[model samples]
Target: MIVTPPSAEEVTGHAASMYDRDTQDDGFVFAHTQVMAINPEAHEAFESLVKAIVASIGIGVYEAATLGAARAIGSAHCLLAHGRKALRAGVLDDDGLRAFAHHDDSGFSESEQAVVRFAERLSADAASMTDADSQALRDVGFTDRQIVDITLAAAARNFFSRALLALDVPVDVVPGVSPKTAAALTARVR
Candidate 1:
């Protein structure tokens, strides 16, 4: 990482709390969390927004959108992290995640495919997005609120992914993700 993260002993207040939460949840502090915790307020706010979006839209849908945006942005970090989340949420199996990383939408439902396409377009070229982009979501039976949450999920991934890339943060070796799946997820990153 270009920036040095605070040592565990140096972390205090909200940052310390974040470290504790990560340890409790994931059994370790994620490098991303450690780096982002450098600005605890911003990190907390961003995490809260992500939690809200996930709560509003189901984890399955959020992971689909996030994976799409991550692929579009060529973020190996997001792809691996969200791929593990998708697996844990029962949204995708190992084969399904591999297919997604390879840009094959065959394993996904029509609604999920639509969400992925929409997120890919938004992340890759938001400037060219039109009303039709949102219309696609409606066609797939997404309500306005669900659509908004999906947008938030994708946009938020872009923000966090870009920050990691900008800072040259090393991608975490996400536990529970298979090596084959990890290679597929990172294929585009190189």
Candidate 2:
């Protein structure tokens, strides 16, 4: 990483809490967690927003949107992390995740495919987005609130993934991810 994060012993308040939470959940501190802990308040706020988005749109859609944004942004980190999250949430099987990472929407429902396309467009070129982009989601029966939540999820992933990339944070070896799945997730990263 371009900047060294605080040591576990050196953190306090939210940083310490984040470290502890990562240890409890994943058995170690993630590189992204440690890096983000450098600004604990921002990290906490971002995480809270993500949680709210997931609660609003549901994990399956959140993961689909996240994966699409990650793939469009060439963020191996988000792809692997959220791909594992999708698996744990029962949103996708291993092969389905691999196919999704490769830009195949065949495994997804119509609504999910719309979400993915929307997220990819938003992440790749938000300035070019038109109202029709959102109308597509509406046509798929997504409420305005759900569309907003999906937008937030994709935008949040772009922010977090860009930060990690800028800082040169190494991708964590997500637990329970198969080797092939990991390879697929990172296939587009250079």
- Model 1 poorest 10 in a row by lDDT: 100-109
Model 2, residue 190: distance off in Å is 4.0
| TM-score of each predicted structure versus truth | 0.94, 0.95
Name the TM-score of candidate 1: 0.94
Query: Which 10 successive residues of model 2 have the least lDDT summed?
Result: 101-110
Candidate 1 wrongly placed segments (more than 4 Å): 25-27
C-alpha lDDT of candidate 2 relative to the true structure? 0.90
What are the lDDT scores of the predictions, listed in order?
A: 0.90, 0.90
Residue 152, candidate 1: C-alpha displacement in angstroms: 1.3
Per-structure clash totals for the candidates: 0, 0
What global local distance difference test value does model 1 have? Answer: 0.90
Mark the regions of model 2 whose C-alpha exceeds 4 Å error after superposition: none
